[model samples]
Target: MAPTESQHFGVNMSSLEFARSVFGEEEDIGRSLTRGSIPGDMESVTLDSSTPWRLKDLELPPEPIMPLLIEAYFSRFHWYILLFHEPSFWNKTYKVYCQPTWRRRDLSDVVTVLIVAALGLQSVLQDSTWHGHNTFRIHHINHRQLLLDLVSEVRFHLIDLLANPRIEAVQVCTLLSCFYMFHSSPGLAWSTSGMAVRAAYALALHTKAPASQDRIAAQIRYRCWNHITVGDSFVTMIYGRPASVDAAFADLHELEHTDDLTIPPVLLDLTGFSECGDITSKVTFHQMKFRLYYIIRQALNRFRLLRPSQPNTNDDLVAISQEIKDVEASLAQWCQELPSLYNFEDWSLADRWAQLEYSLQNRPADIQEHAEVILLQAAMIQLLYDGAVILTHRPLLKYQVKPMRFSGSVIDSMQKSLDAVIGAALRISSFPVHKFEKHFVVSIVFHYLFMAGVILCIIPTSQPLTNTAQEAKAGVVRIIHASRAMAQHNRISRQTDKLLTELLKIAVQRETLAALDNTSVTGYHGDEAEPPLLDSEMSTTKDVPLEGPKELLQANTTTIYQPDLHREFSMDLPELLQSYHHTLDTGAARNELSDQSLLPSALLPLDPHSVFVSEQLDDIFGSLQSFYS
Candidate 1:
């Protein structure tokens, strides 16, 4: 569709001229027109339709093409152009003239041309659908070339124009930032990003700019989105491949106000770019995440390293501590800040941002399963901190250095702090929390902390020498008990009350004689010195032949057997002992039965016959000793 004549005219007029027409001639149109240049007599230039349109020609004052061409022949040129030779003249002249004014007219013409060119390039990248065969590589190369030309043409002039109108600077910077970030060649994009920052700051510092500080702050925020875009680009590039997560991070940090913690959410919309499924873009997304993580990690590492040393150095330790506390506090506050819930599963740019409230505000929580990942990360960090605290407290141990000891109070405080965190994890794992299904990880963390606590409790950091046997034995006993307690607590369950079920089992077994009743029994010869017995009488009778070498079973066919074969009888031990001693001797069968009870129930049951009839007569002696000895 062709633009109407009036639309063309609107595009040609500068913002000052448009403003003049809107307010009528009585307004200060002359002053506005003077600041923005007018083409010198508008006659020396010609519209070069055969070649790519020079951006400067498009930014010229509104005038008839024929008359402007005629007047150009007589105009006196500037000394700067006179000094340059023919080749340089054309290049430098075209360059200087392209950067003219901040008015709408100056931008519209060039912007319109650039937009059309961009659309053409986009068509080529999208041309694969039309062609049925992929022509993306060819088109992609062409597209990059076109973008490079466009950026080169606009870089200088755009910066000059944006120096006073921050909003305009922000808009231009944002567009340029995207171009730079998404370009196949990001090096070119970075150059423009640098220019954009210089322009934004220049505009921001202008005392005469009409907006109040608060209003300008909003504008600055609006502009920051561009820098954020640049940051995203750097990250994506570095992460999708191991290009340089740190370098990409450096790029993000280079932008002014990148850490303001109060920029507009749109600026921080790291996920808003085109789908990065392609090879080129795939690394881009990863790099973006890597960059953000890198930034946060670097900050954290720096704070950690600096924090401890602050106390020993001339630096203000309290201030450094307060800074860290501030960041932590801000993080907690941001989490509670009502998130933008307008979009169901898709969060809006606005929803994604809450002011840094503290220093660690540039983090994102957008990937699938991020909650579990972040939870583990938080726990890992907590663990490292706990270990460090422990290391600093240990005294004269192999792992401990004499100069590395922390104060006793410091160790005590850190232990308390860790205990609280562990307690929170235990509570989280035990009860269901909304939007927190990854409680299993929390359970693991809790278990780790609990075991660590037990170890810490049992191992003395320092102790006085004492009685060798008694002290050593007491320490061993203490560790054994503590280990048992830790093991009992470490059992986690996927099912509700699974822990309680096992606890109930233990309670029941403790109170009932069911376990004792299953013990192996001993054999006795009526008031005679008994010979050994055979286990064939104690094993499952179902697996044993009923008449099984009757001598091998037990001497007496009169002996009675119960469903539980552990309890058995024998009238003749000597004959039974001779035949079965090779298979099931009973020298200490009662003791063996007692030991077998400790084997899990899932294994074989202890035989009562071995304990009752053998030397284990002690088991039954308590109840019927009068009949035995």
Candidate 2:
């Protein structure tokens, strides 16, 4: 029989067809472009031909504010080092503005500087303090509006900037991508990053420079290409989409090194001798970071290709499992090979906590730089490592087999993955919330926390809880608190805080109910003479009907409460836990619960009728949509 349209697509085709054919025709597709939606025919989209080149209308910050903004960019957004030769640009821009001919500078360079300045101001205002007598205040609202207006002025000339693509144009697109990410617009970031990648490829930035080119200029091109590649890989991972730059086409040349008592002349001239060594070190560090991300991108691509539309055969499942393990091994080796400067081995929790406290109360210039630069780098390395581990083991959660035949090793791997995620979260929690909030992407942090919550929910049913479980729960709570703190400044963090709260409650309830079941079973069996089997054995036995108190039914209902996304977490726990006992008297209800091994347990097979299983998968995939859309 042919499947109904609704059955196959989960929507009424007639309604879709009517909407697409009728109402869609009445709508102006050009207006959708203005609303930031892509059109079906890219060539048909209209551009405003009459928009003036109003570069003079662009406002420049007062002299003091200009330096502050530039400082903020360098202090906070260090990842963009490769995109621009900061010292040279800073000096050049300062000199230009100091003279009368600043307005005569290339419009593209002016727009690029404005983009960076606006982002820098946003970062500063997001993390600044205003002292009014006895009060300290953060003035983000007004500053954000100012930043938006600046961004709008640049957006007004976006087409003009891209019209004559050059190195500066690529920088503009890359900076714009970073700006979108700062505002939690991953979709825009992905799009803009792709544009930058394409622009870089057009300029052959991914190929080795011609011998005729200046060596310093060639080195700069190398850095820019890798920057684009790294940015593309990051967005691809977040969106679970294909990358813009083809790996085979990329130039994988390592930075040239020479043993000398003195630095290169080009480096000395670009950034004074005092800062040359630091610049070289940062470039090398970024190169290493890019390599790690490259590995992750390869793994993500393989996983996407291996994803099955239907249940896999035994051999396919084994292959997928081995593939994941191999990736994990590669990730382990990457971490092992990291340079000592990027390593986090020597930083103790106590030391980080101390630094964090100092950062929150006082932002001394030196300490603040240390926290933002060194500590942030270490945190990022750990975050990426943990994220890779999660991605590596996440597939096992969906790989289903008979419960009796399920391998304990998979469960063990998941446990370790969760532990690593929680450990990373704890490390991040030690950073100053305001600084961390500005520097880190909230969605990524939320992803890690959500993954941890899912693992926490399942572990109790799959195996006994341990001290590691308690530590993991505490880590979740700590990260939730950090998210809440950030929610004050960032809208995305507010959404993340709400989601984490819900997931934490669900995890707590699952653990609580599992404990209750174990207790009730022990008490019930103690009253009889038969020897009690292990809890793991009993939970896995399909033929054994283990008896428990009637209250277990009530607990099950409360544990798996229907999640209402719009509702707050205000339900009465004890009452909800006790209200469903009346249903236990019905034999059909009891049999249904028994046949399914309880209605909402995560340990059950992936049955369509299982509410918890379906909801869990939906929640995981739904969170993923935030990155792509």
Candidate 3:
């Protein structure tokens, strides 16, 4: 009745393949991160302006209301795009509005303002914390229609501006991409960004313009190009696509100083006065993320996806070993080098706003202006930093694919990846479920968590699952729970959460099947079906303290999982996972999970023969046998 080694790996392949397929299908890893279009199921956005409106016909809010929208964009949304000079933009806006005349050539600035207003209003509307937007949330102003009208107007002039290839067009394109990113339209964002980058190329923003251009004008060009690069490199990196920026030209015009702008323009990147009335020397969110992502993109390119080296070669293992050490060392160095304003290393694993609370309390007076902006940006930077660390060593997930008995060097490298990737994923899943509801959740945070969740599903969790495997599975559960909580609001989040939950259920059930080969399926009836623990081999798996659902390790055999000696999950997720496991074991995969809204109709049914599809056992089991030998 003992399960054969083939059967053991059969279970492994089925779950791993499902994990691969979930992200593989719109699920579209076959090409890149395939984002789904706005599903019909998305809460139907009510648009009041059904009829088409022209660019000049699209009216801005009244003159008095202009400042609030601009403030909303600068304070709530500017950090994400970093496209405008606050003072200069406002000055131009007043001039355009006061003159009451439009030049065919001068509509670019108007369009840029239009996009910013849309994004700013959207951010304010989406985030419950921003009470200022509530007053304008009158029944008459359909924010969605207003947003649509503005975007439609911008589009009318966008082609002409791009045809001419102006800096204003590039700015408009950059900000527009951000608007698309939030609206569940990354495909549009991606295509629009390509246009933005290509237009920048046309303007030759990659390299310095000749002395014929004014000094201030040249600086603004560098600043605009910098924004485009942020979007291009970031989107491409996360999407598993190629870089759109011309690196060859970027080096020719490697400019260090981007013209700084503050929310108040006087607080230039938060280095000047504040609500506290003190000249605080703070690094702006834009400056920090701009620098952070540049470094992260470089690390990702050099180490993982971009420049792939052979995984089977001895020389490659040695090289990877070196890279592993460098990655770990660099993470520490990067954290140390961060300015105190954005230093979030301590809060990386903590709950939302924890660092912000401590930080604000320690500052002069009770609080400072724009503190929330700093808080949101720091959290994002943390996620990006951690996500990059995981991808840097993601290839090592292959080590788990077959549970290799690797060389000492290979073991060291594989363990480092496990520690880094799972550790990062664990930290990401550690954020409270409420994080999904916030405006900060925009900018591909959901995708990053989904990426991590898929990796968690791949990590080895054999009998007497190692602490690392327990933590990995625990991390997966937390993500499913969080995403599921937000599923109703976000269609992508809902679908991903359900799929991952089903995948985890299947994974757990497969392990159970592997352990219960002697038990008959018909005998799996009601409460009596919970199989006894295989205690004969318990000592090894029991060496570590239980950090998650103890039921998952019911079979205490020798583990394939290599537990990280470092961290453990301190969150309450494990206990909930324990209850969730009980539901699974109690013939409740159908009823209990659905009752909890954890699984929907899409939950793959558990047929007796459907447990493990051995067919996917192609070369997926991987061949490091030569290395193992």
lDDT values for all models: 0.31, 0.53, 0.54
Residue 260, candidate 3: Cα error in Å is 6.7
Q: Any residue pairs clashing in model 2, and if so which?
A: none
Kindly indicate the candidate among 2 and 3 with the higher lDDT. Answer: 3
TM-score of each: 0.27, 0.65, 0.64
lDDT of 2 by residue, 204-276 (tens): 6766677888665566677678778777777776565777878666545565432211223333332112322
lDDT of 1 at 439: 24
Worst 10 residues of 1 by lDDT: 74-83
The parts of candidate 3 lying over 4 Å away from their true place are: 1-66, 127-139, 209-219, 251-285, 303-332, 347-368, 399-405, 432-443, 460-464, 514-629
Judged by whole-model lDDT over C-alpha atoms, candidate 1 comes out at 0.31
- Output the worst ten-in-a-row residue range by lDDT, candidate 3: 594-603
Better of 1 and 3 by TM-score: 3
lDDT of 1 by residue, 26-101 (tens): 8765553243323222211122122333354323322232122111211111100111122332343333334543
Best by TM-score: 2
Best by lDDT: 3
TM-score of 2: 0.65
